[model samples]
Target chain A: MSEAKFSVSFAGPLVTLQDAGRPGNMRYGVAASGPMDRLAFDAAHAALGNPTGGTAIEVSLGGVILNCTSGAVTVAVTGGDFVVEHGGQKRASWTVLAVSEGERLTIRAGRAGSWAYLAFAGDIVAQPWLGSHATHAPAGFGGGAVLSGHSIEVKNTALREDRLGDIPQPEFIPDGPIRVVTGPQDRYFAEGAVERFLSSPYAVTDAFDRMGMRLDGPELDLKAALSIPSEPIARGSVQVSGDGVPTVLLSDHQTTGGYPKIATVISCDIDRLAQLRAKDKLRFAAVSPEQAVATCRSYLETKQAYLDQISIARGTLEQRLMRENLISGWSEGDERAAT
Target chain B: MPGHAPKFDAIADHAVLVSFADTISDEAHAQVIALDQALAKNPPQGFVEAVPALVNLLVSFDVMATDHAVVIMHLKALLDALEVNSVSGHEREVLVCYDTELGPDLDAVASATGLSVDAVINAHLSGDYRVLMYGFAPGYAYLSGVANEIQVPRKTKPVRDVPAGSVIIAGPQCLVTTLTMPTGWSIIGQSPTRILTGDPDAPFLFDVGDKVTFSRINRATYERMKDGTHHV
Candidate 1:
């Protein structure tokens, strides 16, 4: 086996290797433990003009530092906001940068988002369990979280021709309350509970993790006792605990739950909900399943546009832009004037 | 059987849950099992897996590969044309050691049912149980057909760490756990079955519709089976 590409010097409190995750493992009581921000994870590769598919390091709350041990590797950082520095020089995230051997890259937490994805050109070397490399940290399965002093290997791949591209960032933060759809057990809630849920604003609490997020808000009262005859649950389920607090299940939620769920967050907005930090205000808006599906399609289309816009060609932006004859007066011979 | 009008609703962008009944019962489980088996036989395009629970079936699909409406339409047709009477559920014999050492709550369970310890054990052994669903944890099977005479309510205070393979019953269900999770159920016996192997290709040794018959065994037998030197 070839030597590891880089050595981790500081992996924050919680970091894990993740891919799209194993979806069909629910029968064995496994949750789909993919990235908290799916679009951000995809953007990590899209920004780099790399095809999506590989285990990326998901850094939570950020503060990860890595030293390039051997071999130069191209890296892209996306999702949330983070201050990224390579060789003591500040570098913008959501764009590709090369980390040369003996160099260092440090990532510090930003004020905006909760999760960030650092994807490399080659797939991360790890054993796949249940057909997934997505780390299920709670269960201690799959590629567990990154720790300090650990070395990670990146499989060899042909170097890409593209050096830089305009990072396709989300143009605008989506406005309005997070959208949700009434669930199979919506009827179990009291008459006005669903309305109360929609009208009231909930605060994201510190009691949050990959498994779920507990939101403190108006108590969504049930028509009867809260327990159901244990049924299957999916990510984004708004399960009300006996304490009357509503918890939105995330990527690593349990396969099944007995708590009555009033509504499920629409799929397109799950990433938005995941980015909400503690003390952030949250509201809910109800939509039909069909509307939710349509919204998902639109979001997917926007992502595709990002991939299509990637202009793959060459050296740094300065080098390529100067070398190309896109401008009438700009040419390689006019490099002095361009400078 | 015709009284059941299964309801299907979207749970997420890629998953829909089909409920056979609002309450748990043999009929509801039957419909759940039938739908699970039928879907397995002719799994629709973009189908991932159908997780059958007490009264509902959670079906997941690839939203990119297929539309949500298309899946709902196919599920509706499957329910309408489904023949649930011929489900071939497998039968497996489970050996248990109901001694005081392993079954710490045996006395409590026996007294709660107002029966001698041996009588409680015998009644439990005589149960004609079927795997109702797997939930709560990996390879943890919720079973139906707990003997009515031995049925007991969950403990007022749950035990912190019930060992894996601890055979327990709560309300009307028996659960064989592959995890050492906490529970409020009364522990009446201990089994020597490795329900969860953690291997993806061979994850669980049981399924939703498997018939289970518990047979009483001694500590020595339990130890041997637990060690994988003998099969019960």
Candidate 2:
């Protein structure tokens, strides 16, 4: 057996191993416990050319600290604009990091965003439950979260020396309101409740976790006090509890719920919803199923294109201006002129 | 039943929900089970998983491999050709220790039903239960076939912590708790068997439409069984 390479020195409130998550086991009463921000997670993997099923550390608010126990290794830090420090030198996120043996790497909380991700070049050595290494915290499955004393091992420890170029700005900036499709149980609410849900702004509450997050917004009065027979629920399901607060379900959400659902967030916007911290303003916009599907298809296409282009050199700021090729007589094909 | 079709709609961008009926009924439950069985027997392309609930089936598909439109089309065709009445589920026996010590609500249940404690136990044991769905927790089975005479509303104040293997009942439904969780249903018995083993080969013991019958066991047997590690 390979000796552990990384020892967790500090873990915030919750830090767990996450991958794409187990997809087909929802019928077995297991939730798909994947990364909260899938776009960021996939971007990190794409940044490193890592294969699927490579487990990444999901560092929550306050971030995490790790000490390299053995040989040097290459790692990538992405998501949520978290501050990455390598050997007491501040480094930008979305860039490759190198840590030598006995060096400490700390990820401190960022001003914006609630979660961050640290991914190694290869798969993390952890047992898979239901075909996923992602931790489902509520049920105490998937080995729960990584504690301060936990030692993590990667399959390939050989270090890659070069640092990948960093993007100037973080990815996945929310441009508009969260989009939703009116639901399987929209009829259960009283008249105009859905309109109120759409018009009024909701704020993320402190009562939040991987399972779901409660939103403080206008009351969504229900016609009946009783609950319908428990039915299947998906991530992004906007279920109004008995108290009338809307809760957007997330990873590790229950398979079935008795509460009534007014709408469901489209798949493309769920990652945007995951990054919102407490007190962040959130609004919903209604979209037809067809529109949502088309939007998702386009988003997937763009994501693939982005991953394909990651290997190309982004060039420095001056070179980027020249490459725009807008100005006349600025430069020719000469490498020196372009530089 | 012939000529019955489910209402198909999008619950998420990658998921489609098939509602067999608006209200929960035996026929709707049977259709849910039937659709699940048929899909399991002949799963379509890009099919991820199907979650069968009281009267609805939520089918998730890989958006990368297949679109929502394709999955909905295939599900509609499957519904048109499915034979719900022909699917037979597995039968299994469960032992419950219904002694008053383990079942704290025995007297209350008896008083509410206007029957003696022995009569309540006999009524509970007489009816053959069907697994309607699995929810709330792993291996937590939602069952039907509770005797109408003994059916009652859930407790106003739910218990804070009920141990695993606690047999609970509310209205016309019965549940065997697979994990220690808070519940509003009345605990009427205890089972020593572990329903969730986390085993890949057999993660759960019951499937939708499976037949279940409960038999009474003495306190000593319950204690012995609890002490010894038991699996379903």
Spell out the clash pairs found in candidate 2: none
Across A20-74, the per-residue lDDT of candidate 1 in tens digits comes to 8877767667777888989888878766666775689888875799998887777
Write model 2 residue lDDT over A61-170, tens digit each, in one string: 86788998886767888877788888778975777766778899998777777777888866688887766788887665674688888888887654444335563232
Per-residue lDDT over B119-189 for candidate 1, one digit per residue giving the tens place of the 0 to 100 score? 88888888888888776665678888889988888878888878788898987789876667789998877
Model 2 - which docking category? Answer: medium
Per-model CA lDDT versus the true structure: 0.79, 0.80
In candidate 1, stretches whose alpha carbon ends up further than 4 angstroms from where it belongs are A5-8, A48-50, A100-103, A157-161, A164-166, A311-319, A323-339, B93-99, B161-165, B187-192, B198-200, B215-232
Q: Which candidate wins on TM-score?
A: 2
Clashing pairs in 1: none
Q: What would the TM-scores of all predictions be? A: 0.88, 0.89
Interface RMSD of each: 2.8, 2.0
